[model samples]
Target: MASFATRHIARGTTIRASDCGSLADRGSSLKVEALLGATDQQLRTSGIDYTITAPSFFMQNFISFFTDDYKSGTIYQPVGEEKIGWVDVRDIAAVNAEVLLNPGRYKGRELTITGGESLSYTEAIAIMNERLGATTQFVSITDEAAVEAVSAAQFPEFIIDVMISLNHSIRQGHAEKTTNTVQEVTGRPPITFRQFVDDHRTTWL
Candidate 1:
């Protein structure tokens, strides 16, 4: 978010994300942690932005979990009944690069980015199975069950519960979708999940 602002906002230079696959919603602070965890040199190369983008329901992923999650053979995504906005890294990168190179057209403004489809955890997993031949291999784990499951692990129970809460939020539709954000900036239609799978499924298989 701030990246878009600084290059376009302050420096009057071109800016682009290059990818959003790693981006998460605001509350999912894992992104912040990862960014902060970066070495000083990394930040210097990346350049700091004024403000980061926040999602009403930022469901970038549901895996900001502790080690115990791996034991379950299935990862319970930390999303609830929300239709959060999700942007693919490719789409974000493509748009940002385009806007930055043509700053005269898109500068000093916030752009909402997404894969243009709001997918719930179940819906999202199902698509992977259908299009990419990847089994989601997960069963819905209750918060209490998850808390119990992780109690024996190294992580504190409180942290386990919090992650569960994130999943609950995604199921609830807190994360909405606005496909136009990508279209508005790029002047082209955003790619769909099917296309994403076709392009990358080979690696997974």
Candidate 2:
């Protein structure tokens, strides 16, 4: 039972407990949300691919703990340098396949997986705008005071602060680092944020 974490690394595993209701499944959803930093005690009882995914409005929304301001229409993008480490479901399965083929290398160790580069969500949208010709408007809110002022009247009590807090982390470069785990383990440079967006920009609207 070991543990590993970075600011907001990518965790690319899924739920094994589909029919259980317990502390092991503590989250804001009926489906188990990925906990990027799992404790050693928790690790002892399960097989997991470890990564420390940075918190964002994305995770909060999926877990049913988000305000509408962070949604696609209202804010539409991460405010600053938010680098999300996403483990593509397919890529993760491939890594697991490699480990299964040679168990000795990955038996009791933690590895970092990245979605390649650390680009801001606005940058991501910009990339899409260039390639896909998207015209969705992006409104930039620069400060917590502004976020709170807008959120005070419209947002729920739970997310007024939490949603705005992501702005601080993004602006401070808290999520700007990129790990070479994908290249280190797979012997190839990881893909780019542009590629992922290019591949999936159709879903952006």
Best by lDDT: 1
Off by over 4 Å in 2: 1-38, 41-87, 140-172
Task: Give me the runs in candidate 1 sitting further than 4 Å from their true place.
Answer: 1-73, 132-137, 142-172
Write the residue-wise lDDT of candidate 1 on 22-133 in tens digits. Answer: 2233334343323322432243346553222222232223322312333333456434444545555667667667665776665334455666776655675566568755
Clashing pairs in 2: 8-53, 8-54, 9-52
lDDT of 2: 0.45
Highest TM-score model number: 1
Evaluate model 1: give its lDDT.
0.48
Can you give the lDDT of residue 114 in candidate 2? 49
lDDT of 2 by residue, 1-205 (tens): 8996532222333221123211222342322232322433365345554332221223222113222332344344346445544334445445555655655566454544445665555665566567756543455556755675757669875455545544544454444545565566667666565665565544544
Error of 1 at 9 (Å): 4.2
**Minimal lDDT window, size 10, model 2:** 15-24
Clashes of each: 27, 3
